[model samples]
Target: MSLPKELHSSKFEQYMESIKIMYLIDDRFKMICDQYCISKIKAERNKQKSEKYLYQQLENENLSQELEEEILFYIIKNM
Candidate 1:
């Protein structure tokens, strides 16, 4: 089986964007990845790979708010 070129290209680009955005949003993510022996490269890559899928699924404004709350809840809970 083979994927279309455009689909493969877009998926690759999204992965790059996610890694770059995560780095910009929090340098600590990079540090944590390193300190814990996480693959900084793979961490950035997976984050990038999932960014587009995540955004597309959460595009509804009302739902985004709800999702934000959920994320915040988890953050606070962990803290």
Candidate 2:
């Protein structure tokens, strides 16, 4: 899949591999946004701006192993 120029580097490929795994779990970006209490517009904005943060959260973070859990925290108690 083609990505933004900024995401065309080798490190991006590594991240993309991990990103692909996340997508495999649930590619429904819309659903993910809803579950995460995030707006569609906000998600789109984060596509570029939050790539680094997302990569970190997805790859190294221990709080949530699955992207779904990481996204839609069951204990948030608020959306």
Candidate 3:
């Protein structure tokens, strides 16, 4: 599928709010986060990798179909 839509900051905020709601109701959200490597998140948070690398990781995991679309959308929106 094509890359997700371009996100504005307001859109991002709204998406995050939606995620909080989803996280409470959907086990899939938690499962996706639990599956993703913590160290990878730390690395991204610390800006240890290039944006290209971050996108690559997301794209690869995305293609693997391991994450539910909502979780992937959340991750991409945040990134």
- Top candidate when judged by TM-score against the true structure: 3
Q: TM-score for all predictions?
A: 0.26, 0.20, 0.31
Per-residue CA lDDT of candidate 1, range 24-51, in tens?
5777855553453445456777998799
Report the lDDT tens digits of candidate 3 across residue range 1-79: 2212222235456576565566567788645544554544566677856777889998998777755777889999999
lDDT, each prediction:
0.61, 0.56, 0.60
Question: Residue 31, candidate 3: how far off, in angstroms?
Answer: 1.6
lDDT of 2 by residue, 1-79 (tens): 3323443356557677655555456558435534544453467788867897887876766644575685668557466
Could you arrange the candidates by TM-score from highest to lowest? 3, 1, 2
Residue-level lDDT for 58 in candidate 2: 68
When sorted by lDDT, best at the front, the candidate numbers are: 1, 3, 2
Better of 1 and 3 by TM-score: 3
lDDT of 3: 0.60
Backbone steric clashes in candidate 1, count:
2
**After superposition, candidate 1 runs with Cα above 4 Å error:** 1-59
Each prediction's RMSD over C-alphas, in Å, is 18.9, 20.2, 23.2
For model 2, the stretches where C-alpha displacement exceeds 4 angstroms are 1-11, 27-79
